[model samples]
Target: MSKFVIKDDFWELFPQAEIAVVVAKRIDNTEASAEPVRPDIIELLEKANEDAKKFITKDPLSENEVIAVWRDAFKKFKTKKGARCSIEALLKRVQKGKEVGCINPLVDLYNAVSLSFGLPCGGEDIDTFAGDMRLTVAEGGEPFLALGDEEYDEALPGEIIYKDDEGAVCRCWNWRDGQRTMLTEDTKNAFLIIESVDPGRSGDLRQAAQKLEELTVKFLGGTARIEFMNINKKEIPL
Candidate 1:
């Protein structure tokens, strides 16, 4: 089993945070149509959009509870909001009348689960990672390649990131994924992460992770494994 570690620095700052990690292996990895969106996935996004509109109507993006937690995190980590987290980005798109569209089988499946649960969910090709994975505050100058970018960028000191032995895999927590580990049509092994700051929402987190596992296995033909971690539990074998 591979190991995934959350550093003490992160727990000390956000003790209430929780994360669900889902690992899938033996995936089909063959190219397939990600559209038109499946009926179940469409329903999930539609309902999530309705829920988001309710709170967004009452307050600005930074003030919305679901997005606020992440905004606060970004502030603590010395980064600005807006493009700080995946969930916030998705919510903003829905607020602007843009429905989340399918990207690929794996991406579409996880996006559905993310919107449904109102959390930041992301994944990477496990094979691209070097050695074990760690979630920690960067010390500065770690190499990172944001999705769709041609050049490498340096991660700021004190910013939270997920990294492997070679370099950073994700920067600013779930804000952006490094290009090297991005999931693609040839991804046979994947590591999916669902993050939540609400302490009382563990049940929802577990359900969302399980749903991702089910969807991945059903659509991508993988064997799924899951692990849960939080301030109370620091590490898990993947």
Candidate 2:
């Protein structure tokens, strides 16, 4: 059976960390690849970019609470050079007066929620995962082909990763996702996550999960269910 499991190895690093999940089924993402982006989705992204500025309390991006928390977490594990949390990537773009562009319907919607909620949000195609999905520290050398890369790379030992029976699904926690299970226009069922390393932001993590579910159901025509994974709960069947 396919399930998403957070191994104890990961919890050993950040015991109080919370990962919020949303499993969406029966989605229609064809519009994400359309030439002219839907006007409503465009507005949603624009507002989110503007709203994200509230979290930018410090001049340097690293000083912000959300960015700093992830930065500290990454230091506990090995990661690729220059890899930063996905939320930092999005917030950086917004901080520089640049808008986070749309990728696909599901991606754009999650990016919107990520920006608005100030947490790292990501998703993958549920059908593409090989057997169960796992969150753990890599033993090193799990084959990985990142999004838009022609050659394959390997996950570093001691790095935080999400992997399946086939290979690595995401590397360095939420920094980058692999192309093997990437969400695309043809995707119908999706598994989404919003991660929080700081215990103080637990409320924000939960709010992001709800907002993501609302947007996925409203725009993608799906039945989305939300779940929280922590020390007490570690797995959910896909």
Candidate 3:
């Protein structure tokens, strides 16, 4: 069973929320590809992105739009393709205005799927995550970046991210990932989050993340730690 380190603050943040986490078995020193890629993964991304576009846009974005902000990003991913082009570009469009970076296949996949699902998920290089981890909001003026290596003067507060004793393992929850804990070609241990907007949606979100987990093994040659994080409704995601 996945261990949940629950606190009273969780209920206080999300009085009517139900949250859960999904973690996969850990692997050490597994190898990833350096040749960029061929086609299969790309094709998979194309199809999965289409599915996510439909799923994410279903919600509002700002005040009342559940996933409308995703619509802006979907339009970008739908048309871009290249050895250099990446989901980092699309994320740049919707990060509520922030910087990002580029890790590798595993990290890239996490961003792509999140963009597709429109749910804003993330993955981290477990090597950097250390032993214990938790999710919480940003504290502002943290001085960070996503995958593109851009600079951040502010993260505001209430922005969800997977954090360890060090600080932020995955910033912006599902939106942007940190370069410090990115999955490189040398990355072996990976922690993934298939985030859910609410309790009822957790099942679908978790299932969708499973597909990505499968692909990680198919290409990365390592065991994985997959987690399904059910967002607490009472908690506002910055």
Candidate 4:
């Protein structure tokens, strides 16, 4: 059995931070990815886009509380020159009045929850992971083939990353996902991650996790278990 471990290196930076994991199994993520998107999923995503606006009160995007906290966190470690957290990317689209399109059932549901809660959320195909996965600072030179790209973008030393024995699964924290473990319509088992660095948003974090868990099983026909971790609870079976 593989395990997911959050290293001490990560906790040393943000002691109050918490990570929520939703292990979803036996799900069908392909139904909504066909040529025509499902109406219910579309409605869910549209509402989430509108709900995301509540977190962006500042005129300038970066000045918002949610975006600012992540920006400051990125500065604490080495990251790619222009890399930004996933939440920033999603909220920016909402700010521009651009709706995020549906990818797959599982991805769409998680994205909706992420946007609605204003937290960084991501996932990986559990079956694709090489071994035990970890959230830690990279040692640099770890292999990373970004999604939709043909080349490798190696991880930088001191960069926060989610990795398995094969190499980097996600580079620059949650900024990007590597193709090796990215979620696809064919994926049956998945590892979803909802990250919270702002201590004040702990309530939002739990709510987001619960929402994601409910959506996963409802739309995808699966069983999901939610796990929360902090400095004290650092590991869980994957």
Give the residue spans of candidate 2 off by over 4 A: 32-37
TM-score of 1: 0.90
In candidate 2, residue 167 scores what lDDT? 84
lDDT of 2 by residue, 1-238 (tens): 5899999999999899999999999988887444344788889999999999999989899999989988999899999999999999999999999999888888999999999999999999999998899999999999999998999999999999999999899999998899989999989999999999888989989999999999888888869999999999999988
Better lDDT candidate (2, 3): 2
TM-score of each: 0.90, 0.96, 0.62, 0.97
lDDT of each residue in 1-238, candidate 3, tens digit only: 1223433433344433333332433433232352445255555555554544443232233322334333332232211122111233443345433323233566556555665654555556656654466655555444455567766433545544455555655544445566777766555555565544354555557666676676666655556545433333322211
Please report how far candidate 1 places residue 146 from its true position, in Å.
Answer: 0.5
Estimate the overall C-alpha local distance difference test score of candidate 3: 0.47
Model 1 local distance difference test score: 0.82
lDDT winner between 3 and 4, please give it: 4
Candidate 3, superposed: residue stretches over 4 Å from native = 1-8, 15-37, 53-103, 137-146, 149-159, 225-238
For 106-142, candidate 4 gives per-residue lDDT tens digits of 8888999999999999999999988899999999999
| RMSD in Å for all candidates | 2.4, 1.6, 8.7, 1.6
**Per-model C-alpha lDDT, please?**
0.82, 0.92, 0.47, 0.92
TM-score of 2: 0.96
**Between candidates 1 and 4, the lDDT winner:** 4
The predicted structure with the larger TM-score, 1 or 4, is 4
Which ranges of candidate 4 are over 4 A from the true structure? 32-37
